[model samples]
Target: MKSNFRHIGLAKLCGWFGISRQAYYQYNWETISSTLEEEMVLMQVRDIRSRHRRMGTRKLYEILHPFLLENQIKIGRDGLFDLLSANHLLVRRRKRRIQTTNSYHRLRKYPNLIREMIPTAINQIWVSDITYWKLGEIHLYISFITDVYSHKIVGYHVG
Candidate 1:
């Protein structure tokens, strides 16, 4: 009968079989392949991603293919994607919410006073307006004074 531990490092074999390395190495003297080409490829991929995290699979494939081909390594785009997914190296895109006017508030509307009036000199007329902002748990109001002649802001205050 062939001994289960005849030709492999016990620790590595245990790691492959999901067993305790200490327990297996204590009783066995077997070793797996010393060539870790696959592991090396994975590490390289991770390193590239760490440098250019925003890159997608196509970009990553383009960057890695030359190196891999030079080393005579055979891997396809899909294969690389699968490897990245398995290793949790795939980049995720976050979707941002689009903000638009709701036009649902029940408030009084005002008419535009400068619709027909055009400023011809500095300080000919001053326009003022107020707006509100929510800061933390408090609401604050901001007021601004502007010179319509020069179209410059004259004063502003926030509370």
Candidate 2:
């Protein structure tokens, strides 16, 4: 096909494909335009990432909104994601573990007294637990007690 096209003129090839020469050139130009647009987006991503190394794609899109408008580049969130993924420029998230329970402690551990017991009515067996809740910049501790039989929260404390 390459050799045959080399011998054949582009106008003739366009005619064979049932398209005009102008349409053929327009399609080629569109490919080039898209390539250039993607390159520009990649450049902007790299520039933003240089300052904020761990910035995610959503934030990058927000930052690039103004630039895209100025350059008349049309790209959506998914498009930006695909571009960043293809270029291997996406930010890797850090795994920050918040250790609330220390199971390795040598302190006395309480045995489950109700392991063999089943609740027949409400308030017969109550379970208590604590959980951590992060609201914006604040850390909250939620302590709650529930009834086993009714599956209802009997008591709760948020601090």
Task: State which candidate has the highest TM-score.
Answer: 2
Worst 10 residues of 1 by lDDT: 26-35
Distance from true position, residue 111, model 1, in Å?
19
Instruction: Give the Cα RMSD of candidate 1.
Output: 16.3
Where is the poorest 10-residue window by lDDT in model 2? 1-10
Model 1 residue 72 CA deviation (Å) reads 1.2
Q: How do the residues 68-128 of candidate 2 rate in per-residue lDDT, one tens digit apiece?
A: 9999999999999999999999888899878778788889999999999988889899999
Estimate, for each residue in 1-159, the C-alpha lDDT of model 1 and write its tens digit.
777766877677778988897767644542332135456678888798788878888888898888888877677899888877877888897786555456578897788878899888898889997877766799788899999888799999998
Pairs in clash, predicted candidate 1: 8-30, 8-31, 9-30, 9-31
Per-model C-alpha RMSD? 16.3, 4.0
lDDT of 1: 0.78
- What's the C-alpha lDDT at position 78 in model 2? 98
lDDT of 1 at 110: 80
